[model samples]
Target: MKLNLFFQLSAWCICLCFSPVLAQQNYRNNEDINKALRNLVNNHKSHASLKSLTKTLGGKDVWVLTLSNGKPEAHPAIVIAGGVSGNHLLGIELSVKMAERILTNYKSVLNQTTFYIFPNLSPDATAQYFGKLKYERVANAKKTDDDRDGSINEDGFEDLNNDKLITLIRVEDPTGDYMPLEEDPRIMVKANPQKGEKGTHKIFSEGIDNDKDGVFNEDGIGGVAFNKNLTYNYPYFKSGAGEHAVSELENRALLDFLYERWNIHSILTFGPSNNLSVPLKYNSDRANKRIITSILKKDEKLNKHISEIYNKITKTKDAPKSVTAGGGFFEWSYFHFGRHAMSTPAWWFPKFEGDSLVKAPKNRKANFLKWAEQEGIENTFVEWTSIKHPDFPNKKVEVGGIVPFIMDNPPYSKVDSIAIKHSEFIIEIAKIQPDLKLINLKTEDLGSNLTRITVDLYNKGLLPTHTEMGAKSKWLRKINVSLKLGKGQEVLSGKKRLVLGIIEEDSSKQLSWLIKGRGKLQIEATTPHAGKQSITINL
Candidate 1:
């Protein structure tokens, strides 16, 4: 009996020793993500399928997972994207987890709506999260001269302290523009000369002048940031914006796929910019411009409504403040692609107080430090230690700051709950997708072979058939109402085919056709996004 107990103890120890190497609930690398996606597809083969939309220059596949119960082409769709900015690892995890949850528990939603989930658009850059030397990188694998110095990737980051991770490097100089924050000395704030404050220090990324170009890490490894390479509000000639909009293989492939998918009426992207917590304010001037750059008035209201729903579901308050920067996919989806677009980080650092219950710092980094300290999260911040630098020989140089990607992502254990809530929100949105139906059909015979047919095409769903921008762009297919008449039949008043534009929520379009026809006639109404309906009547 004693020998048996000893053997069991040894077996338990072996299992514990090998457990760390096994996959856990955490941010996944590219290989792990691929394996998980394949497993998910294989497990739910009937409703889910996986495929590569395109391949990056570095040979990483841009994978997409499609889910639907019925024919996806026959229903409205939502496009869920992650890794729009490569460093946002939480985006990728949230996207994957939401897909899994939807496939497992919320399979019923697939009956009405289709979902296209791009798990990671920037796979090459996201892979840096699992590299031997980890750092937050935004651009993809392609190499380019970002500094326009004619040398490609010549001035990349260097581990000045040899810590295997890139942090911030601070130099104490009299003519610098930064000063230590009063609340936390570990954090820095820009000097306010108007407030009688003087500049005393300069902050730079953790690196040295590799090219001796007077700048530190200006031309970094990688090129063409996925978020910045989009067409809408494309930053002309800007670094990481690429030579032109949609210039990269990934961008072109995604746009090409989107161009063909007329049923995609909504887009949900997990990225740096978020409108879920706080909806964007409507700008009438921007909306009325010939180019129409802003979110319209009514759509802003919808965004607010959805924001309330998101808050109610996630129970998130005091969300981190974020502004949607120009040249992002989030804006492009609404302004150009003409879909209801929603973007969120899905998780961020909750406000934290110390063991002494001190007030949270106002600065984001300082608040994060306090939170990390209270939670006892190790390796989140690097202590500022003085180091000799090649460029700043006489200045005091210290390499240290909050670790990259820590503030944007939460612990893996907390991600499952977040994913569940987002999945619920997505399902709710799907339930509200535009449902077109034929209502109040009437047919009256005036005389021999003479009939007047009238019908109202109603949008029974909460959202409009097409977005305001969509109606303006005319990119989405118009609502087509056709009357199939019998042989030797003709229409005297209205044309045989009717082309109508956007139909708002709970609204209907009254269509009348005075036709000189006999026998049974069929009237059909259809839009690529809103689905189809048909009715038959006799003359």
Candidate 2:
């Protein structure tokens, strides 16, 4: 009996050691996510607070978690957003997990930097992953007519093979625009007319043309995509981009919350777009244009520096290039919102390195399949099965393709480590936020009870107090330096209060003032985003 009890106690200790890993064995649904968020606030009430910015059309709460030791607006802030794309479930997981890890281990950093985490921004569409008929959905549940055919969701996807999964359907035809790649026949690629490639197969989303408009699944369920519903470079009249920019309730809610928070200096998003692994290049013409499309030269330099830090901390390499689509949240955050914005898909299929004799495939689909096979990931691809279709009755048609959401999100077992690396990266970034300091103080005793006071207002952190674009934007607050005089004191020379421009990292500006009379004078430098500093001197 004594031996059995000892063994039981040992087993309990082992379980405790691996509890965190075991708990995250699967992705959380909306209910689970809400409960987990509530529990986090309950457990870490001192440093973490949870609030719902608004409810989506699907009746899901768009939650934002604010993490700080003191008043959140009093310190420099970074906004970490996730689920910018509904198909990327890993993003939602990363945002929530990063918050939990930060509050648990890196709680000390909260004293200097505040974090506003918007996890699962596309909750309405992300919920479709857990729904029965799963596909790579991007839009919310606002009921849109995507194709503008005067019909609402009439040509949505159908489970042609009764598989309960929305895969692809291919039909053999002479005039087809798509053809199977020679390297991997399982994958399809657009036929290149310039390369003398002949088309043999036509592909469409697994569905029939219910509207009889010759388009299959053109208008699906759901409405605006949050990533494509922002104000910058909006894709007008585009599917999933909404009727206009900031049209959705979730979009308006997020922007309203962001506009109210003057302390947010930078924005980081976990989604399909990536600018962290490889920084964006600066184009002189684009930067000089009236609208300013490209990243400013100084800001581009900062992006490159931060990219190096991200690659070093995450050790991520050979990331696939992702283009910033019009109206993307990633671009809007920087171009229009005027903050230091950075985004990453957070995960991707690592580059396939074959032996000397075996050359890797060039096509993305072929490469992903090769990696998936090596990793022993199963059920990722559905085998092609012949099915009789109503649309193409004469031609031979089949349904099969890579499963939805798997390519963008890794298996659940790998998420914890991914979350840890991202959490570390975020903490490192917070440590380097622009910190204002008053240094190099000097005082001279002038004749006739007059005194000369000199000090250098310095930005000691690694990042500039304002991003180059932010400096030009009227939305951001300027750095204000003020001299508060004691009783019977008057300024004789320099202005009592002065507004300053951008302060580059590790740079300082000297300010000298002549006072007619002084007892105890206080000098204070304040900025909503860079933080505040003050000092007192006696004469």
The prediction achieving the highest TM-score against the true structure is 2
Global CA lDDT of candidate 1, please? 0.87
Clash totals in order? 0, 0
Give RMSD (Å) of candidate 1 vs. truth.
2.4
Residues 1-539, candidate 1: write the lDDT tens digits.
99999999999999898775565656888988899899999999999999898899989999889998868788889999999998898888888899999998899888888999999999988888888777888898889998888899999888888888899899999899999999898887899999999888999999988888788898988898899998888999888889899999999999998999999989999988789998888898888988878788878888898899889998887777765656799989998888888988888888775545587787888988888877888888888989999899998999998887788888787888888899999998998888889889888888876888788899998889987777878877889889898887898999888888889988998889888867778889888788888988877
Candidate 2 — worst ten consecutive residues by lDDT sum?
Answer: 351-360
Q: Pick the candidate with the highest lDDT.
A: 2
Model 2 alpha-carbon miss at residue 205, Å: 0.4
Model 1 regions lying over 4 Å from their true place: 1-22, 353-357
Which sections of candidate 2 miss by over 4 Å? 1-23, 356-358
Write model 2 residue lDDT over 1-539, tens digit each, in one string. 99999999999999999987786676888898899999999999999999999999999999999999988998889999988999989988998999999998999999999999998899999998989998989899988888887878777899999988999999999999999988788898999999999999999999999999888898889989999999888998889999889999999999999999999999999987788999999999999989989999999999999999999988998898876778888998898888999999888888667668666898888888888888898888898899999889898999999998988899998898899999998898888889899999999998898999999999998999998998887767899999898889999999999999899999999999998885899999999999999999996
